[model samples]
Target: MMRYLIALMCFFTLQNVYADMTLTIMDQDNKPVSDAVILLSKESVSTPDAVAIMDQIDESFVPRVLAIQKGQYVNFPNSDDIRHHVYSFSKPKAFEIKLYKGSEIPPIAFDKPGLVVLGCNIHDDMIGYIIVADNSYVIKTDKDGKASLPVKQGDIVTLWSERFIEGVNTTKEINITNDTEQTLSLELLPPIEIMDHSMGYGFGKKQW
Candidate 1:
């Protein structure tokens, strides 16, 4: 009977070490920031096998910003009736899919960790971003700027947003613990530019 109690205690201890945490991000004005990426540092992380999609519709990428684990595949499907050219010159990965309509293009695998700025040769105004991460514990904030994930105590988590100033420190490291607040409010640096979402545009500027 004593051994059974000890085993149960060990199970509870493990649960405490890996607890579910909720993180909230805000801008300098205390407004909930959406589309912010949340990344966790984990030792046993591995590349995901699922293929993500970045579709183009109405001369614009549906989800202007996409977050993916390193070595994951991304399919660029042109939903618009007109042909579009997709390309990126970022260092992490550089490739281009020539003028095409629909999903005829093959999936591109992102093998490195960094931001891949996407653009089109034909449409000068269209822009998109693919943020490749090395760790599997990645989460993007919802419209309310909140995300929940299972995090271990002492684990460091980083946050990224395109709205941040180009040359500023955009990462936030938090030591997770049982006493840590579930809802953390952080004021980020001023944004380089803000897009009019109501007009169907997303975050970030045309520059790399």
Candidate 2:
């Protein structure tokens, strides 16, 4: 009986030792971005399942932007008075939700990893993003543009942005076992010249 009790204690201790790691992300300006998504993955672990995206009212996609595991389903629900034609040319899942007034079509499955840009055929100003990730440790950054990720020592962490320029960026490799807290500061280049209604949608100009 005593040996069994010892074994049980040992099991619990091992479980506690394998706790997840945490990652904190912030922009160059040290401001918290509420909707930034973070993803973590390792070759050894199997990829997580997929999720869904819903299309709601006001001629806008619900959640505005979403990050999900690869193979997840994205549901388009029309909650508006008019019809919307939703489509994406992303290599992962290139499909379209033809003109529909309500929730008539089933959810779309994204089976690969890539950025899926969503748009409405009727509304030229409507835009959204579907980021399909293979990692299980994914999270959307809070209002402070910060994201805490559960990770482990020696794990490879990566950060991505749609507007990330080719060069003029920095990434720091952190050793989790060496320090309890790690802070990274990156300087982003100025925004490129482009014409769009991104300002109307409440997205400010890309300022580093």
Candidate 3:
């Protein structure tokens, strides 16, 4: 009889420990952005370990946007027939993945918190972003631009996206004391045009 009572108490305790919060991100036109990235952090929460980024065929970064905690490892694997040179010039960690063909090399560790822009020297069209955050409760938006955050009551959650300009968009803030649903709408300006310089590969010269 005592064992049965104890088991019931433990189950209820675990249930109360976990909470859920829903987040919705929308553009100015009220359309969901399927490719948005979501990040969550708390002041007292400990930073979690980092993750890796794998490079697959066609010289493209799988999961174009990735999120990791500070001081984590980002593995860059070249699963293609040709060689690849992966390098990042962001403020967090600047390093290069030399020309390689297989997964024999170790992963790169990013210890700082910043945005790491990745590009392949061999493939000019390949581009990726690595966002190293300081907390563990983070997730990427789904096709409907919706994400559920597992957070406790009174935790501050911040949202970030490359599409929204810093000064123009308003970031939605909320407290997760109960199951709540919130929508965020951002008005983004036109993206800055970058000069293309990929014509040197002998594919036919074109003006930038």
Per-prediction TM-score: 0.79, 0.67, 0.70
Error of 3 at 42 (Å): 1.5
How far does residue 144 in candidate 1 sit from its true spot (Å)?
1.6
- Which TM-score value belongs to model 3? 0.70
State the C-alpha lDDT per candidate. 0.75, 0.61, 0.67
Better of 2 and 3 by TM-score: 3
lDDT per residue as tens, model 3, 10-54? 997667555466777788878776546665655334555544655
Error of 1 at 199 (Å): 16
By TM-score, how accurate is candidate 2?
0.67
Please report, as a residue range, the 10-residue window in candidate 3 with the lowest summed lDDT.
199-208
Name the runs in model 3 displaced over 4 angstroms: 1-18, 43-51, 151-155, 166-179, 189-208
Model 1 per-residue lDDT tens digits across residues 41-127? 664467878888887866887577799989999999886778899999889999999999877688999999878889999999898
Clashing pairs in model 3? 50-72, 52-75
Clashes of 3: 2
For candidate 2, write residues 44-126 as lDDT tens digits: 33444443646545667766668877767777877667888988887778998889876667877777876778888899877
